[model samples]
Target: MFKRLRRLRLSSNIRELIKETRLDIRDFIYPLFAISGNGIKNEIPSMPGVYQMSPDVIVEECEQLKTLGIYHILLFGIPSHKDSCGSEALSDTGIVPKTIRAIKAKHPDITITADLCFCEYTDHGHCGIIDTKLKTVDNDATLEILAQQAVVLCSSGANIIAPSTMMDGMVWMIRNQLDKAGFSHIPIMSYSTKFSSAYYGPFREVAQSSPSFGDRKSYQEDPANRKEAILESLNDEAEGADILMVKPALAYLDIVRDIRERTLLPLAVYNVSGEYAMLKAAQTAGIIDYESVMIETMLSFKRAGADIIISYHAKEVAKYLLDRK
Candidate 1:
C-alpha cells in the first residue's frame, strides 16, 4: 500500500493542522529606520515598502504594529550629525534615543530593540573607531564606545540592545556596562555571524552606512567559512550574548541550523535588505508570486531553526498570518 501523504495535503485545513513549521507574529522583529525630522516617511528606493521615518511617524508606526500584534521592533538610526567617534550615538537627544523615548511614550507595551552600531553615525561610514596608523578599526576603543551606547539606549527605554558591529568581546562589554548602570535586565542580541557579503548592497542605502573606503571584511565573517560561523556564535555565547544571530539569512541557512544545534540560546536570523530587494524587484517585474514567495521565505527561516526573524517583511507577514486566521 502507498503511504498517501496526499491525504494531509488535500485541503488547507489539513495542511494547517499538520504543518511542521509555522510563522507567528511573535516570531518576527520588524526593523525600522529612524531619521531626524518631523512627519517624514521617506520610502527607500530599493526597498519599496520600507521607509526612513521621523520619530512622530515612528511612534505612529509602532502603534499600528502593536495593533497588529507585532510587539517587537529593531531600530536603526540616521543621526543629523556624523563624527569620527560617532558621538551622536551616545547623546541623550540623539535620533535613536529620541525615537526610542517617543515610541515608548506612545506605545509602552512595544518592545524596542535598538541597533547598537556606529556606521550610520560615523562620518567615515565604518562600523567603529578607526586607527589611522593601523588603517583598521580599533577594536578595544570601539568596545568602550559600544558599552556607552548600550547604557544610553537602555536608559532611553530600549528593551534590548542588538550590537551589530561584530566586534570582539562586544557582548561581554555591553552586558557589564548594563549591569553597572542598573539595567541588568536588558538582554543583548549579538550579530554573531554577520558575513562580508555583496548581498548587503541595498542595506547600505537604507542605513546610509557603507564604508567610504574599504569593506567590513576585517570584522565580519568571510562568507566562505562555515566553521568560522559556528565559532563566532560560540564566542558570542561565551561572552554573554542572550541571543545569537546569523545575518543575510537565506544564503546562510546552513549556518543558522549549525548555530542552532550548537547553542541553546535563542537564535535570530536577519533577512536583510538585499534579500528583500531581490524578491521585491522580481515581484515588481511580475517574475514571481510575491505573497507566496515571501511566506515561503519566512517559513524557511523557521524550518532552519531560527527562533526569531528580523525582517523588513515582518509587517506584511504578520498581516498575512492575521488574515489567514
Candidate 2:
C-alpha cells in the first residue's frame, strides 16, 4: 500500500497549494550598471537584455521596474577615470553616489543597494589597493577604504551597502564605520562566499573589471572547497553582516543550502551574467523554451534555500509574472 503523492499533482490548484517553494518578484534584487553620461542605454552584447545606462537612463529604468512591482536594485558604477588607488570611488561626486541621489529623488520608494568594490574604478582592475611586494590585494588597506566608501554611499541615500570586494574583515570595518557615521540603521549585505569563477566573463565586459595582470583567485574563494565556503559565510555573519550571499548561484546551490542550514540571516544568491547569457543564447538558437526554463531555474534557487536572488533575468521574470496574472 503506497501513499498517493500523485493526488497532489493531479490538479494545478492542488500543485500550487502544496508547493514547497514559490517564486515572487519581491524575492529578486535587479542589478544595474550606472556609467557617466546622459541619454545612454547601451545593451550589453553578451547579456542581451541588460544595459549600461547613464544616471538619467538608470532613473528611467527604475521607473519601469517600479511599474513592474520590482522595487529593489543593486547598483554598480563605471567611472570614466581610472587610477591605481581607485580614488574616484571615495569621492562625494563619484558615479555611484550621484546615481544613488538621482534614483532616490525620482523613486524614493525604491530600495537601492550600492555595490562597494574597486575593480571597476582601478586602472589595473584589482579589487583593492595593491600590495606591490606580494603583487596581490592589500586586505587591511582595502578595509579602511571600504569603510569610507560605505559612508559615502550611505550618505548618498543608499538603503543598503553591499561590499563585494571579498577582502578579509570587510563587513566588520564597514559596519563599524557606518554605525560611527550615524548610519547604524543601514544594513550590510556581504558577498561572503564569492568564488573566482569563469562564469563572470560577461560581467567583465559590462563592468570593464578584468584584472590587468592576474586572476582574482588570490582573494576570491576557490570553487572546489566546500568547508571553506561554509566558513566564509559564517565568518561574515560573525562580523555583523545583516545578510549573506553565495555567488554564481546555479553552480553553488549546495553551498547556498549548506549556509542556509547554518545561519539565520537572510541568504542571497547571484544568478550571474554568464548564466543569464547562456540561457539567452539557447533561446535565440531555438534549443530551449526560454520562459519555462527561466521560471524553473528561478524556482531551483528558491528550492535550494535562497531567500533573495540577484539576477540579470529579474526584469524579464517580473514581466513573466505580470503576464501570468
Model 1: residue 26 alpha-carbon error in angstroms: 1.0
Q: Tens digit of lDDT per residue, candidate 2, span 202-273? A: 999999999999989999999999999999999999999999999999999999999999999999999999
Worst 10 residues of 1 by lDDT: 1-10
Number of clashes in every candidate structure?
Answer: 0, 0
TM-score of each: 0.97, 0.98
What is candidate 1's CA lDDT for residue 38? Answer: 98
All candidates' lDDT scores? 0.93, 0.95
Instruction: Residues 165-280, candidate 1: write the lDDT tens digits.
Output: 98898999999999999999989999999999999899899889889888889989999999998999999999999999999899999999999889999999999999999999
Instruction: Give the per-residue Cα lDDT of candidate 2 at 114.
Output: 94
Off by over 4 Å in 1: 4-11
